[model samples]
Target: MKSTARIKQVLVLLVGVIAIGSIGYQLIEKWTLFDSLFMTVTAISSVGFEEVHPLSRAGRWFTIALIVTGRGSLVYGIGALTAFWVEGDLVNLWEKRRMERQIAALRDHIVVCGGGETGRHVARELLRTRRPFICIEIDSTKEEAIRKLGEGMLYIIGDATTSDVLHRARVEVAHGLVACMPSDKDNLFALMSAHELNPTMRIVTRAVAHDAGPKLLKAGAGAVVSMATIGALRLASAMVRPNVVDLLDAMLREPGATRVQEVTVGPAVVGQALSELKLQERTGVIVFALREGATQRHVFNPSQERVLQAGDVLMGCADTEQHAALQRIVTEG
Candidate 1:
């Protein structure tokens, strides 16, 4: 039974016993309401308090019965209450219900699988960007730690490889999913389940082995990242191009530092020329690449004469304020 239900049952038993004792004392001893209640309480609690009035033979027998039955019920009820409070079950239940409601209301959110190093980083980035997301961690210990780490982040403690867990996280309404399970097989399974649930969801998975990358892609993953390979490449780049690495690190670590971001061209800018838009001059955002909406082709350092398309995506680098301005200019007009 659920803890709440068990608690309710215990409460009901205690109340029933007390009520019976109170009514029995009133009928057998002809005591007033207050005196009967006081007598019943003292009998059940065994508080060594004297009776409110002298009891007759029938009343004494009834008091004995009340003490025998009510004491056990009262003790059990108190123990149950103490256990529930000490174990944090009530707080967990409340949090679980609140998270369920939030998950049900979420749409176009990201679902992150696993709460390991990579998954935590993904969650933290989403949090920093103020994006909606849910993290699924199978390990209860890790889930608790992740909950403490991300104060307001939504998460579920369940095996991500299972379709039921994914559904619970509302993968059907999610815009994307990131599978960062330690095992490549688990990541592949999660990706396949998510793909089956939401065929259009963009899925990115981590591969422990190089061969797993192709399999993950064939299983409907949009991108398969190999952390080991990336780490090796980054190490090599740090050695060969120290200044470039330093600049990249600075962009990620420093506040207000220029970083690359993507903004989509809205309907208002459909037929405008890149030169006319003048994003560089207005928002200090350098448009480095233009991705065609229909063909999914990218034009690096797009020509000024190129006409902007409604669904085209512009990749540029800018500070926080500049990025916001560019987004407003693209989306608002």
Candidate 2:
């Protein structure tokens, strides 16, 4: 429990004990309640005040015992108060308030539901892309792991499936979310909640089981990745298609030099042919493929007859400078 909560509990118990003792003293000694309460306070505080009246031997002995017990309670209460102030509970309260402020200021960030290996990798990728993001993990150990990544990231220490936790991550304004929790059911629940919170927000989740993919998609996830299946395919590709693996490895390792880019055709390139764009010569980029809606088709060595469509997504290899050029071509020609 928090120090504040512990202190409150201790004070309540002490107050109950004092109340009961004062009422009992009034009944046993035939004194007024006010006088009995006053005596109890004096005994507890060791105030050295005179007694209400003369006492019998039993009452005199009882007074001594009351002094010792009441003093013990008072000492215990003081110790608890000191602990409340010294154990950094105040710091925690302040940090929580600060976290709320940070959440309120966040917009268009990604919410990572787990801080595990996969979630950490996603966070690293998001960081590389310079995207704002927050992490939510129920496990304290995992949260510590995430904190080691950086100080600017906002984190919520709670279950992701809860709406309040999602709210803490600013789901309303978040552009997307990535859920990599261990349980498929929990991920689905979190995805559903996030989607409900922001209907337009993209939700991506990982599934342990192949069957979970459909359920995750049906539950409102924009993308559902099955790690086990993808890992197996990657292993197979590494064995059978070494060149493809090498190309991906090079792109992944070269942060600014070479990257895999997705360029969308806009009004400027709506009616232009691939040759007219002259991207390969102008930007030194290789057009690897074009994804037209759901279906992706390789457009290697595309001819001059290939006209660019408004919504065509070209996946290609380009350097940082070429990426900038490609963005300009797509947006401004």
lDDT string, candidate 2, 227-309, tens digits: 99899999999999999999888767666556678888888778888788888888888777776643555566556667887
Best by TM-score: 1
Predicted candidate 2: what Cα RMSD to the true structure? 10.7
| Model 2 CA lDDT for position 196 | 92
Task: Give each model's whole-structure lDDT.
Answer: 0.88, 0.83
Task: State how far residue 36 of model 1 sits from its true place (Å).
Answer: 42
Best candidate per lDDT, number?
1
Quick one: how many clashes does candidate 2 have?
A: 0
For residue 201, model 2's alpha carbon misses the true position, in angstroms, by: 2.7
RMSD of each: 10.0, 10.7
